[model samples]
Target chain A: MKPSDKAPSEKALVPFVSVDHMMQLIHHIGVEEMMSGIAGYIEDDFHRWELFDKTPRVASHSEVGVIELMPTSDGEMYGFKYVNGHPKNTKEGLQTVTAFGLLANVETGYPMLLSEMTMLTALRTAATSAMVAKHLAPKGADTMAMIGNGAQSEFQTLAMKAICGLKSVRLYDIDLAATEKCAANLAAQDIKVVICKTPEEAIEGAQILTTCTADKQNATILSDNMVGSGVHINAIGGDCPGKTELAAGILQRSDIFVEYPPQTRIEGEIQQLPEDYPVTELWQVITGTAAGRTSERQITLFDSVGFAIEDFSALRYVRDQLEATGLYHALDLLADPDDPRDLFGMLQRAAPGNA
Target chain B: MKPSDKAPSEKALVPFVSVDHMMQLIHHIGVEEMMSGIAGYIEDDFHRWELFDKTPRVASHSEVGVIELMPTSDGEMYGFKYVNGHPKNTKEGLQTVTAFGLLANVETGYPMLLSEMTMLTALRTAATSAMVAKHLAPKGADTMAMIGNGAQSEFQTLAMKAICGLKSVRLYDIDLAATEKCAANLAAQDIKVVICKTPEEAIEGAQILTTCTADKQNATILSDNMVGSGVHINAIGGDCPGKTELAAGILQRSDIFVEYPPQTRIEGEIQQLPEDYPVTELWQVITGTAAGRTSERQITLFDSVGFAIEDFSALRYVRDQLEATGLYHALDLLADPDDPRDLFGMLQRAAPGNA
Candidate 1:
């Protein structure tokens, strides 16, 4: 049957989530709550990882940075993220990374949501890190050393507080002002915050260590000696070719876990290692197919380069919340003609002659 | 530098062209004029095709349909289209293909334009076909046949009339109401329209023939006997594996042209031909690197499965027009924190105590 046979009101137009609306939702729901909610979704999706059709993100690299499209589907829903990375963008008064994404119905291939994912990415990335930490970090982990404090630092602190029960954060950045800002932001919450002069100082005695520096090269933010036994290392900054945060010895010493092995092999810190080096996929641990942190003294490393599945979970979570709160503004993103075949007729009717 | 370092008003947000606004623009400009303008942009871009970084679209296929992302860039600008094809969507009262795209600056990796391309795709596909016809069709060609009169039929007719000097069209479709509706929509224009009972009757004596049927399987809409010498065929509907329009015999007899040979070889009619079947890239002919129609009696076929460059050109054209007319709404698609490094602070400031 054609669209003409359907009722006028039955025509489908996809709902969109804009950046302003996302901010409103974050404000209304509280960022801490949003991060926790997304963490739940990430955990739920990760448990069913075998249901998804996953692939490495497609990237177009240039001298300045890289632009990527990360797409995934789980038979019922489809999602993708359009993201860019330009470390130099900060110098030009732009964010180092920006992103937007879409969620669509797998059955009909119609987009259900269009959302600004720059903020969502920060939330989701932190949530994913925390989710992994919950599985791999030692029990009663109370302190996290947040190295390379920047735009993402606060979200890391919030997600850790919500998901991993982190109560205190030690912050350090090459730029002291960034660390100061991170410490001040965390102080606004109920959590305890500390400012450290160096990475070694920040990581000392911390149960969890997160390196999220924004540099575009292979800069070692953490050495093997700085990390302690049983510490869960959430490596978030080393996401592109030639950009890594950990020393090779640290990776060799830890039980490394990754999102997708093929992608992480190319983009994660493992890019520095030989192809045959062993690593466990996080989903295996989440699904109880593999072990996570076999011993309290075992150093666990989550070499995350930010996978597409996290974005999928984040988009779906945000979309559901927006629908529940009725906080999203609908965009005329798809033409809803009275007769779908009469799209041209609608244009004609709206023309000057008809008007 | 922080955003506050510059005047607050000087920070510009990216303008968004919604599908509703794009439809309104088409109405204001007249569908005929809009098609002509987009055709001009496609032609201009095709002439400089070598300047573009082109790649075959990346597709994720499911049991029901396929979702795709097509990306291309010049050194200055980059663009990509997120589109899906599910012929079964129409049965569920949804469009078979829905798309949206982004245009970004290569220098800073900043997204400059994000617009809905569901309606825009019909416009660009028609424009691209007309552009190829302008360079490849015989001189003084006017009458044309459009098989498979669906949502795309009227746009193709308008583009042909405005770009290729077609004054009359013969429409044919498996669904009779589709042809009638298409003919009625074109009644206001100067072109004469006829509803033909069969594809053979539609193509008889026509200088140009366009087949745009939407079938997910290999179904021949045009036979070798129906095609005449000197006729320029715009075959658009057969764009994926297991989907085609012209019969293999007809393809063997015509001089075929494609957008990008590497891509079309797999997705276009050439999928039926030998590995080394002779075919010309439309850009070659547009740039005078190859000859188009050698004589009035030569049968030329443009296997036009819409390319990323055409969308890129149409996106830039629409963006410029939207800016000139001030018809687009600005979307805060990207977060603009006071300091780029203080994205988390934006949330902190929005907290209850701060607010």
Candidate 2:
């Protein structure tokens, strides 16, 4: 028998969104609008959280970082993300985090969407943060203090503007160049961008404080003295075990809300506290089952550890918009033989020179 | 900001082998040779199984099927397979199992290979069976009794012929058409094929009995009365809970061998036995740390549920062969930026009209 390369069947082609295509889709919809769009999907899924298969993300941790598989289903559709986080990668001219995701049919288990999620993850993470802020921030909040301006700083600031109607963003990072890069990126956007020299100065007079430093340590990007009452804090940096950005004193003082308590307990700011530390589920707040910001003097904290359902929602949103935007390629990713049982026959018929 | 779909950088492209390409590659090497090749890799990895990170596959079970993520790493490289098993799918003109896999560098956590594993999985499963049979089968075993002639029947037989020097095969299935299909696929091969009407007839003079029926429930494909002494049983179909092939009495008499005892106990034929049932790990036997077939009357049953390390070995083999074959597409699956920290800049630079 000879060998031949055969073309994939129609059923084998999965709609794939590359990073460039994702950027095009985002720009076509506008980054801020896309962020708001993803937030809407997140909010919708959170409203019906009981229907989802809410298993924890499966992880493979090594000495340097962790690679995780986040999967979820809503009876009809299923989705999973393959994401890796290696903080040391940035020093080696690689992104600290890179991701790709897939959406499939629960009934058939055939993949419908294959997407590059490195950019989309940044988008969804920011969108989730701002969406939580909209629920927990004080009324008439307009300013946000963004500490540790990095890859996510600009997107987080824009998402807050788009979803929570934030007017001004103050950026602060120990690396001055990172702050400058973020400020330059947002210079042409609608909101005000202020490059602050210190985290203390960045939080002054701000109604919302977002901490997004990228270190795998327990460094305090925002200390107890830096936070004030009547403010919503979005902590996006401390997402893995042994990694936290805010001081422990601040957690003790604030009302903490988290996405899926089981995961957040292991990989969020609350990991510093006792296992039984009281925290509110953000889904309950979205569904009005739990209280949000109640008093002007109280500080509310959204411990934003990423979740599988959020990736599921993001994949769902991509699949829904892909056809309309025409921003994806058909990926030959699965096998579909005419006679499924005769898989061997299909291979034999694909012999070289037969075609 | 404008949007443009930029071509992925060389670093960002992952080599993708579709099912069609997988078949072509297999044909290029010859199916029997490919089977033996995969078996060799599986055997090598089995010998050093202690170096691998062994964990139970993460599964999401639906009413009709399951979607699973099987991940394993050898400190240097990481691999995982996304596979689904739906027993009723063949009735709907879909394969009962479909899969795709990814291999990545552990140092950088970046994907290096993305291949369609639907056909590769079939090849690897068969190779694994043959490799285990080489260690546990009766002395001078030349014939195999295959009870389920489904998609895996021909592959299994060919693999046995290539690796274990099998000279003849006896095939039996509840569906006559499946048996005919298996027989027809092996008609031109080097081995003699016999289509049997019943399980008892199939195992008449065979020294190895392999049961691979596709039933979801524990319907005994092989009972204690039919089995003879000194024969090895390769049980492949009983891969999930509530799914078993051999009778509990057969399990009681045979010396069970398994890949990853914790996983096999939950998803293999041993699920019918007590949790503390004595079983030897196949790796220990391959490494000469444990005993194999001891006497002419001893029955060795390999309870293979398939492990991540096997898939890892398969992925590694494909990656090594990819460059020589040129049987892959460069999938733009990862986002690579000129400045890793400036992912936003990459997206912004991709704005169509701006460029």
Best by lDDT: 2
For the second chain, the TM-scores of the candidates in order are 0.95, 0.98
- lDDT per residue for candidate 1 within A218-336, as digits (tens), equals 98899878877888999999999999999999999999999999999999999999999999999999999999999999999999999999999999898888657886766666665
Model 1: fraction of native contacts = 0.61
> A40-96 in candidate 2: lDDT tens per residue?
999999998999998778888888988888999998988999999899998888888
Shift in Å, residue B44, candidate 1: 1.9
**Per-candidate DockQ vs. reference:** 0.60, 0.76
Off by over 4 Å in 1: A1-12, A353-355, B1-12, B352-355
Ten-residue segment with the worst summed lDDT in candidate 2 chain A? A1-10
For model 1, chain A alone compared with the true chain A gives a TM-score of 0.95
* Model 1: how far residue B181 lies from native, Å: 0.9
Candidate 2: pairs in clash:
B2-B351, B2-B352, B3-B351, B3-B352, B4-B350, B4-B352
Docking class of 1: medium
How does chain A of candidate 2 score by TM-score against the true chain A? Answer: 0.97
